[model samples]
Target chain A: MNTNTQTTRLYHTALSPYCRKVRLVLAEKKIEVELVEERYWEGPPDLKRRNPAGKLPVLRFRGNLLAESQAIVEYLDEAVPAPSLMPQQPLERHEVRRLCAWFDDKFQAEVTRPILNERVWKKITRSGYPDSRIVKDGLRAIKEHMDYLAGLLETRRWLAGNTLSLADFTAAAHFSCLDYISDVDWDRSEALRDWYATIKSRPAFRSVLADQVPGIHPAAHYAELDFG
Target chain B: MNTNTQTTRLYHTALSPYCRKVRLVLAEKKIEVELVEERYWEGPPDLKRRNPAGKLPVLRFRGNLLAESQAIVEYLDEAVPAPSLMPQQPLERHEVRRLCAWFDDKFQAEVTRPILNERVWKKITRSGYPDSRIVKDGLRAIKEHMDYLAGLLETRRWLAGNTLSLADFTAAAHFSCLDYISDVDWDRSEALRDWYATIKSRPAFRSVLADQVPGIHPAAHYAELDFG
Candidate 1:
């Protein structure tokens, strides 16, 4: 644990689940990095320069810039090589990566898309009139994802196997943000709910839970929930 | 090289770029596995059971199933640790993962969207008229992506770094599929063109080059090109 490097910097936002996944990875790895909040919606010149795609959670190390949350997390995992998020078995590792991609792709497209577009994106981008159709769809999609997640947790203590990996973090990050707005139906998914409680209670999760987004109030239920 | 136990099987499609990426990884890693061709477009019930999302390139090992090309490729690289696609350094590894995600997300959404939608998706889905606006935007976006890729390759022998990692395979897979339909402008991206030639000529790529979809004819230029 004595190998310390001060040059690691992470460009991220408090609300973005993707950013939070990278943050959780860094914390789990016990890596201290300078966290620079980037306003991706504003598309600032500096942010654009740092990431051509203007995405958040862009990690900079020694003059090299890396974009994409998946990439950043993998880099951190490989760099630290402790408390590994990846499994040792090839098939088990595939399961972890598959779930990670599922959250990034399927969940992002289905659940996060509609809700973020309605509640967060509209407020941030000043885009008027949250599409009711999309909001309805997002809400519906969350139920299906929850059912799928419940099934995964039925056999294992955590998603994508017993040990906590990036998959759990990625899923929790998205659900936590949605839960803040009372968008999550905890009663419908007891196993998944219990699993999240464990993750939310982790030392790495304290900062994320404490984060505040301006002008958007969290649901009352979010505060009362116990991690244990 | 004594650690060899093959419990691997790749679920893929001949024409899909994502499937091709996994195939390239398998070849690079010198891993042998059973290949099962899945028709995702008109998939059987079993395929959907294997992958609920009904996406192609699901890798199975010892009763466990893994979906998503990026995830499948990483699992392969880790499973067979020789001929590594990732760099030994943490920072460099991050660069590779970043580039791979870039192609999978931005490039797929922007460049592959139009061409695939217009040419492949249109024919495959047999849906209504192609959206002109989306197609136009995709064409414009491809130009920008090509330019960005050109700049990245200028400094290194490969996309992520000096070695041919999964990033190069991801890019080539997308470009190769697009090339089948003669969608890419080789003149606008001579550097990428040259790099692609090198990728196309690999022994692993032979299966992809030979792929053909029924009722759809490949462009004349595709057969003539030598990736070597």
Candidate 2:
């Protein structure tokens, strides 16, 4: 477990879904980390050095630096092997990773990108030209994904499987960001809604929902949601 | 690990980086399974049923289905528990995952995407109008990523650290694809070139290099490179 290793340092943004996932894992593992808010949009020189890809959720451990959310999460899971975020079965683990990738890939591209465009990324990346069509598509995709989640939740208690895992945290991280803009339809699937409510109430999840980005505001319902 | 589960099947495509990562891990672990090639682009109904997200490298284990290369690899590492792909130390494990994520995320976005756009994705996805600018940018990015890899290799024998790990396999899978298009500048970094040759020479890696995608021809250099 490398008990000799000191508390890890994470460079992240308050509003990033990827960062939120890492934060949730850390909190679940009960590992204390020094959180450094990195202004990634500013293209800070130090942040760039921390992450060559110029992405957030970079971790500094024992004079070595690691980047990428998947890597960070897996590392955290392995580093602090308590309450086991990953399933022991190879196939079960695969399902968890697949869901994680799905959230990162399709969900991000179809849902998160659109909402972020309407909300945060539009002002951050400065690419400009936020088309309403994309937002409309994003809104639709969210409902579809939520339906899929509902179906999964129908059989299993959690997103990937029975026990709470990183898969739930990954999904919740994305949903939380969208919820900030009121983009997610909480009522779409009562099962997923209930699952989220349970997740949000977690002590680990509290910090995520409490997170605030400057000049932006979360929807009124965010504070009131109860997935449990 | 699961001799009785030898009926396990790996649903994969020959050209996919994610799929290839799983293959390398399986070979390294010396786990044998029936391989079923799924043409994700062709829209296989069975594949779709197996993975609602419709991705490749879905593992069928004892009537149980799993997905995601990262998840599959972790499962293999844990289930087998010999010649560990991940270090026991939490920080070291995180380092391995962080590098894997780097290749999968940043490298895939910057380097592999460009090559896929120019060489394969267009043919597979039938997406029209490829951007020349993006292809050029991808080629440029590969050189930088290679240089960064060389810096790491200069100090360590493998991509992540001293021992062979999944991190090397992830990098190699992407490089193999790029090598097929003759996109890599092999001579630019002698150290990386040598390290890759060593990995390529592994008995486990032979099948991956021998893979052919019907009409598309691989670079002549692909045949002559000796990992041994």
Candidate 3:
């Protein structure tokens, strides 16, 4: 437990999209957070103490331990209202939440988890070698998602609406993780790539850009400002 | 779509916790909602028309379609402020959202899905007979969750805080699905049972209690107002 209660701290793992979402939100809010990498799978004794949910991306802010990525982000947006990630209208806000769930639940289950489990987690956890079949399936599944996202981007500037809302950050979080492993085919959708590049260049995205997981290397164009 | 554009309609499935959570919130807010049972697994083309996410619990309110259960519930609470399911304070609201995620994500993964997939979905989807191994594992998992929830009940009057909030509805949604198959050993934790009983007796819980899935019989005490 970092006794520096004065400073906002985040207990997280780099690969987790949930954690990344919160981190992006915190950074976008301009809150300087002390990042503490937790090997949560090791079942650290203090994990349950910090969060009963026993999950990653637990935020210690203003003397309270907050869990659940969406919950924490929503709280942060409400607590510190600057450069608002959420829109004003209720309907727009609903779209933002829905897209957030799209990445976290649907996209994660279909594309991210299977691909990450086979390619990333297997290597890191020393579980086994990547399953080509699963990776192939995830890659195939991602095309449909890319197409759907491309359709959305054709009409709107961001994932959910016009302005860069939480939806954009939520999507960028997932894509960034998949990008870390070079799973994303930027050539599939130029619109999707453009949207991602726009969000990726933000000052708030700097910390995430610097993430370097041991053993795994970033893609050649990952940190580059203009890969095109 | 139901031609009664004036009335709020929810396209949902009976056993989906996500749907039930929305139903409970709408009922709590005393909003008259027309429930449309959607067999989303069948993949009707119009499903995407109603909800691009193509999931259950798509709410049609104020002539606009809403997807994502949590988002819908939050919007309902915001649109109808009289019976607010969310707390005023950001911290308390965070706790509510966190617990909602606990049941929707963790508990559903640990208990509801495995057991239901074995005992319920197998029958509904005509997949196969109940897999005792999965059923046993899910049942075993429920004990720990019951204990944890019981511990929470000991300290607070409600799941997230002192008042009945979205967390309780989110939890009860999963619990009701488990209870339908007589899976929950209500005797495991007296406090959990008591907590459930109190919530179950509410007017808002009526529609859910009356849920009768075809070919799958409800437990004898499921609909009883004062079942011990």
Candidate 4:
């Protein structure tokens, strides 16, 4: 795709689930965006100026500097109301937020951050080699999480509910990153694999599927339509 | 203050800012809640049963078990719409959510969790004495956060904006917990001090202000409305 400087821009890092979640939302909303990959670990001086928290997925939206992935996604949903990402009822919306937090916070601390820190960031940032123990712990934890998700999928079409919402994007963001490194054991939960496959086939997922980090190669079936 | 047992119930621990944020919002909405202090560290089976994440600030509200403090607060605002905590406009709402995430994720990690774990939780759990290094790090970190917040308070009446939104309550939730242990250096920022005093005087803050952990006594000026 040709770069469009005229559209809104996002300061993002490849494989950062937070950035991917926001990217998925923007794509789903059909908002034209210029993606500027940020080296967040280098701690660019301007990053802190753009976002006091000094985090990635900082969106320059219609001149407003928006930070925070969850906040950004929610804002996108509200501001551009085509294909609403949140449910209409308060309870369903609560479930969506709950699962989003489940991925962004719990699953992140237990699985994504630790695994990525050992496997990916160590390589990209030149920090150190992957700690096998930490990687094992993260891998061990993912099974339970995947099983729990499978249980949820048995009852509902989507992670949050019958309707797809931000929860899917948030969960997909983390899973896609893990999948990029071939970390996720998809066969552990057939339901979860199918759930992910369904989401991965979406048009919004194309940009993510095409992502390539310089050092790390995507898994063999990462972009394949019929991975299973 | 009577335990009605019939009104809505909240499973919470006293110094947790997440729980306090939910409590403050409940009080602000005039919803009476029975606060049940859970020994979450003990890892009760029911805790994980109620909240799959095995975290606190779980609310048994209207026959539904709600977890994730931000999700719960947003749900409350949606369910109980009188004196809405969120602004109508999407941008203002984004600001509120951003600040909430700032306190919950950034501030909690940098300051509240480390300091409280060393100073408060260690004693309550009989783990070990307060680690001065961690406490000092948390204390040192607070100066930057306080200055940033003071800058915001210099112009806006509330942390997020002119309106008293959930952002104020979310911030106050962390501040109040720190203040409970007399850890806050209130003199650092007059604007922040005044802001705290103003929010502290509200009736909604009464329950939290009165909180007393068994081994740890409240600060001399913790509950005083005009201590400054």
Could you give candidate 2's per-residue lDDT for residues A41-154 as a string of tens digits?
878889878777788888776556778887788876876679789887766776788789899988998899767876677766666766888888888888889989999999
Query: What DockQ does predicted model 4 obtain?
Result: 0.89
State the lDDT of candidate 3 residue by residue for B1-228, as single tens digits: 559777788899999999999999999999998998987888978899888767888898998999989888888888788777899999999999999999989999999999988888889889889989888999998999999999999999999989999999999999999888798999888888999999999999999999999999999998887777
Interface RMSD of each: 1.3, 2.1, 0.7, 0.4
Would candidate 3 be rated incorrect, acceptable, medium or high by CAPRI criteria?
A: high
How does the DockQ of candidate 2 come out? 0.63
Model 1: residue A1 alpha-carbon error in angstroms: 28
Provide the RMSD of all predictions against the true structure, rounded to 1 decimal: 4.0, 3.7, 1.3, 2.0
What are the lDDT figures for the candidates, one per model?
A: 0.81, 0.81, 0.91, 0.94
- Residue A95 in candidate 3, Cα distance off native in Å: 0.5
Worst lDDT run of 10 residues, candidate 4 chain A, spans A1-10
Candidate 2, superposed: residue stretches over 4 Å from native: A1-8, A32-34, A61-64, A124-129, A225-228, B1-6, B124-131, B225-228
lDDT of 4 by residue, B63-111 (tens): 8899999999999999999879999999999999999999999999999
Q: Which clashing pairs does model 1 show?
A: B197-B227
Candidate 4 chain B: 10-residue stretch with minimal lDDT: B1-10
Candidate 1, superposed: residue stretches over 4 Å from native: A1-8, A61-64, A225-228, B1-9, B29-36
Local error of candidate 4 at residue A112 (angstroms): 0.1
Give the alpha carbon lDDT tens digit for every residue of B1-228 in model 1: 322234678878766778889888887776666777876778677887889777888876645677888888877787677888877777777778888888888898888866787877787778867787887888888999999989998998999889988889988888888888878888897788888888887877776777787767887778665532
lDDT of 3 by residue, A1-228 (tens): 568777799999998999999999999999999999998888889999999878988999998899999999999999998979999888888899999999889999999999988988888889999999999999999999999999999899888989888888889999999998888999988999888888999999999999999999988888886866
DockQ per candidate: 0.72, 0.63, 0.85, 0.89
Model 1 DockQ vs. reference: 0.72
Q: What local lDDT score does residue A126 receive in model 1, on the 0 to 100 scale?
A: 82
lDDT of 1 by residue, A26-113 (tens): 7777777788787777877898788898788787765577788988787777767798888778778778888888988999899887
Minimal lDDT window, size 10, model 1 chain B: B1-10
